[model samples]
Target: MVRKKFSKKEIFTGIACTLFALLILSLYVWHQTESVSLGYDSAELEYRVTQLEKEVEKLETIKSSLLTLDRVENIARDKLKLSEPKEEQIVYEHIEKER
Candidate 1:
């Protein structure tokens, strides 16, 4: 049987290469994890945007209802005890514009 011995230079080169390969593998894993995390964050942000859009639509609907002329008239007549003016209470005004 013959036994072979590796030289110091060869051993050092092998160890360095192994360390470099490990470093690269770790970097690749870290990058992949970061990419996945960012993907999840982006999805969450998209969901939030959708929720906000829905809320905006709801608020707009409420605003429209509140601002309707019929609603205002009802509030004025019922709550404020206001009524339409009589024919004798009406008046007309004319204004002239100068160019």
Candidate 2:
């Protein structure tokens, strides 16, 4: 049997095709890794947003409780040592509006 010799053009073409296939494979792998990273980042951000929403709701509840009339009156009477005015000490004022 005679050994067949390869041409220079055939060898170059083979090498180039191999290199291109490797490049395409690398790019695909890189894109897959980047997609996974972005997915993890998005999930983390979503969790943080949920936590912040819960915190906002908790703060709103505390604010509402602090603003109640009974709480305010208790704080003023106990902490500030203030008292309501007697009925005899109350006064009324009248104002006239211009048309």
Candidate 3:
């Protein structure tokens, strides 16, 4: 039996098939590169989350410290100089409007 030579249409069809397969492979690689599954991007995100959690804990500690009775009383007495008033020394002044 004689060997049958490939026709031009058949050769072009083979090239098209190869190019299509290559295109599909390239698309797959592109998708995988953009996705964050088991990659450096995921690790970076996890690290950022951990840092944010630590900052939140620090802020909470500072907030609790500020709310203590000692801190409140110290600020009030030092800054405002408020004191208990004696009943006999207490006086009220009435202001008159100028015409």
- Tens digit of lDDT per residue, candidate 1, span 1-99? 998899999999999999999999999999999999999999999999999999999999999989999999999999999999999887554432331
lDDT values for all models = 0.94, 0.94, 0.87
Write the residue-wise lDDT of candidate 3 on 25-55 in tens digits. 9999988987846578889989999999999
Residue 81 displacement in candidate 3 (angstroms): 1.2
Candidate 2 lDDT score at position 47: 99
How many backbone clashes can be found in candidate 2? 0
**Tens digits of lDDT, candidate 2, 12-92:** 999999999999999999999999999999999999999999999999999998899999999999999999999988755
Worst window of 10 by summed lDDT in candidate 3: 90-99
Superposition TM-score, candidate 3 onto the true structure: 0.65
Q: Which scores better on TM-score, 1 or 3?
A: 1
lDDT score of model 2? 0.94
Q: Could you arrange the candidates by TM-score from highest to lowest?
A: 2, 1, 3
